[model samples]
Target: MYWSLITGMALAGAVTALPRLDSRQGNGQVKYAGVNIAGFDFGCATNGNCNITAAYPPLQSLGGPDGAGQMQHFARDDGMNMLGGTLDQTNTGKYDQLVQACLATGAYCVIDIHNYARWDNQIIGQGGPSNEQFVSLWTQLASKYASQQKIVFGIMNEPHDVPDINKWADTVQAVVTAIRGVAKSQMILIPGNDWTSAQQFPTKSGPALLKVKNPDGSTDGLIFDVHKYLDSDNSGTHTECVTDNISSAFSPLADWLRANKRQAINSETGGGNTASCQKYLCQQIQFLNQNSDVYLGYIGWSAGAFDPRTYELSEVPSRNGNSWTDSSLVKACLARKAS
Candidate 1:
């Protein structure tokens, strides 16, 4: 199912190349597009009951075309019991399916760890695997996927309530450096702390993250991964969207990226099926279109084979017998203007 669309020259000059599951071959660079796959990393599986049924994904999405080439997910969280300080491999099959689905669509997939600032509710600085262990976890994961160039590593998901933001940034840099050692070219997504909220990004965690330098102190080859839901408080759980939250919250991040000559992708966003909610969703997409120079694209809150539509943000395509159809929200996302 790997596909490509030959579009005009380049949509804003050099859209990042979307690699394949096995080979990087394609017509040329395709603008990145994506959706998030939740549950595996933070749901019952992470809690220790190990809900294998929900762990696997396809978590299917609406048909038409896979507009977003990226699928971000919690590759690892505290769900599976880690051996010593390493990530648990007991539940790798579920994630393998997710990676495979992204590859099938010829889209780059972002595998994010679902743990917030803490693991098991304990702060990183207080008590957790040392920084070296954090690096080790990624090192092992990257080594396994080294041959899969299309897979992007989202080191951690929504780190929040940290004691030291600067130290956290340094940890993020260290994680990136470690992954580079094993996986040479895979893109790394650096998320800001304070829940990685777009509205709170610039002032809270974006600065320290910007200061994160490569081995040479010159940063490149990374993108900021931020999330913004349409709810009143931007909580993914809610269905209500306050009048201007999306505009005000995300605009600042777009401005900062534009000013800094950097780029980012909204890794998560969603709302219930209401005119207002859909309006905000469409507006946010348009907002990104206006800032294509500094914005890559966005990923809807989620959709998955196992993700029941009962979830407020579930965008998993409708299961039509053996086939699948698009949900209204996914429909709007696919129709977003391509700048």
Candidate 2:
């Protein structure tokens, strides 16, 4: 669900306050629908360093010609309700415009920390950055967006290869405490290790991560963040898809979620624009919509700063004059609601 070269992400900080908002409180067929708006998180890598020099220019810089219009098209035109953006620790303030744009479009904003459980290639807490430092990063951010009801804190993106999964959970526990200390009602999405792989979640990381609780000792606004792709090896790089991942991934994960009385979100899942992707991706999302009881919703891999024609799994809409045309995959699947 991510490029190896430009990985890792988090969101900018804002002090503005608004009313509390929680969109996934009731039983339904997935409460939120959205796409990821990349670019602000362009220069990050699994090593935990974000080179601002390698990042893409701000979408706002493109002005109405297409920058802000991209988000508007997805929200107003595509009926998407949530918008995900990357936030890197080195450039937390870089995403303010992206966040503001998402808010203006009347969509929920998921500020994701795109780091893969490490900083400078050292595993977080286990040996790399101290847990306090991680908590501190969240604390400052939580305080800044405490009043922004539409803000959703994506604790970390795709954690993997941690030596002690239990310790990682403890680190997440601390981050949750720090965030809840400042923002009480905003939703927080927590990702498990192994790239938050849905296939490995129920067994590998779920047990420990499930132990993580809100300060109230409840799992109210906290949701599990999972990712699944349809490529042969599930790396998300190939242009063709080999499976829908229902039996191999989502189905088993769904069963576990229901059995545990918890819910999860498919934070990232997509395939290239092809007939194979069309058939399988549609089925995958349909499964999510059907099992909305334990699933919040799904967000496609991306659609920001990436060109529609050039990007492999492009969900970015193309513009012709004043009209916009969504990618074939989006039109046929991601943007389509349950029947």
Best-matching candidate per lDDT: 2
lDDT of each: 0.55, 0.77
Residue lDDT tens for model 1, 50-118: 233433333334322222222221111101000000145655654565456545544456676655645
Check candidate 1 and list the clashing pairs. 33-68, 33-69, 33-70, 34-68, 46-79, 59-304, 59-305, 62-326
**Model 2, TM vs. native:** 0.89
In order of appearance, the predictions have TM-scores of: 0.77, 0.89
Q: Per-prediction RMSD in angstroms? A: 10.0, 4.6
Highest TM-score model number: 2
Instruction: Count clashing residue pairs per candidate.
Output: 8, 9
- Please report, as a residue range, the 10-residue window in candidate 2 with the lowest summed lDDT: 10-19
Off by over 4 Å in 2: 4-28, 62-65, 86-93, 337-339
Q: Residue 88 error for model 2, in Å? A: 10
- Model 2 CA lDDT for position 111: 81
